[model samples]
Target: MLSQKDEWVVEELVPIREKVYQYLKNEILKGELKTGERLVERELADKLKISRTPIREALLRLESQGFVTTVPRKGVIVSQISLEQVLEVFSILSSLEVLAVQLATERLDEFMTKELDELIEETNRLLAGNEDEEISQFHIRINNFLYKAAKSPRLYEMLSDLVDYIRAFAHIGYEVPGRMREALHEHKDILQAMSERQIDKAMKMTQDHIENSRKAYIRTIDSVKKK
Candidate 1:
């Protein structure tokens, strides 16, 4: 995972407490706060120039989100992301993405296709750096577009939260050789099918795209364990 703490803490676009949560969660997801690392509230409060109440509240919320855990004496520690948990999350992700893409296909037009082409080009540039987490932002953007076009706000909301969980591990796939480029091509193919009004083909491509991503991420983790 790439560094996100600096980005999350900037300019105060959101509420103060929410900004604190975003900054800490960004640190956790980017592997800056390693699994089992105890989080110091006083230090965090001082670092962010806030009081302890909001920090405590943010930790509790992060705990509820499964990104951190309150240990017996270790306070809040970043949670471990297991392979089984990854599998479960990706299974849901694949299903929802396939549905969203299929629905989006029905709403496709020249304008949206042009927009997707632009997004694909942007992703291609990001892939040059192999910035998986940044590329995943585009993933979320595409999903939001698809869900909105699908007229499924609730589904998008669900996906929005689920995406946080997946982003924690998005970097793993990009570490594998050529995976970023392949993922970009997959997005292009899905968009092409959608533009052509081929719902069946788009759906199939979506499924294949997500499933391949999951496999790639898991394969990388397995290889690391072996090493």
Candidate 2:
């Protein structure tokens, strides 16, 4: 019931759109897409060896995920990562992550506790080696494990979207000196609190960690803007 051109378009674009989305997401997370840079659909399509439709679709998805924004009658552009926005995000995320850790601590068994301790040890090693990428991965792994242990589908879904936004700004905070070391120490404290079954202490430690990270991100962004 469709025209040949329309069928061809659909066949060609579906996979291309998915691939483009993945590529853009990674680029944004890696800070390769500079803030305020214009995103040209035609150029991107050509670069990716695809048509405009897929590029547009991918851009729209990125916009929804807060990686980019579109202006009426204009075009898409990378969203600027501001210190204020970072603080706001951290405020909300800190609460959610604390809740997740609290729930996880209550529900996790001995096996999960041992797994968390192992992850902490690995994260400490990565931090000691100054392996920023591995440290980031360990943070993600810890959060994912806690989310899974929490066993709350609704909370996981909410935090997943938040995590996407957090990742977009991760490179900024990751580059800050001493931030990784502080994060490692805070993560250890949270793990210790959890291990001791001190739910309130774990929650507070998680909140404090996020607050400190937010402050560091704000300071870094302010310095960057000044330069």
Residues 1-227, candidate 2: write the lDDT tens digits: 11234333434546757867877877777778878888999887666666888789889998887889887776788897666676677888888998999999999898888887887777667766967667777777777887887889989877876777877875466568878777878888898788788999999998898888777777777788899
- lDDT of all the models against the reference? 0.78, 0.79
* Per-residue lDDT value at 17 in model 1: 74
Per-candidate TM-scores read 0.81, 0.82
- Summed backbone clashes in each candidate are 0, 0
TM-score for candidate 1, please give it: 0.81
Per-residue lDDT for 95-148 in model 1, tens only?
998888877778766777788677767756776786666766676677677666
Backbone clashes (count) for model 2: 0
- At residue 133, what lDDT does model 1 achieve? 61
What is the number of residue pairs that collide in model 1?
0
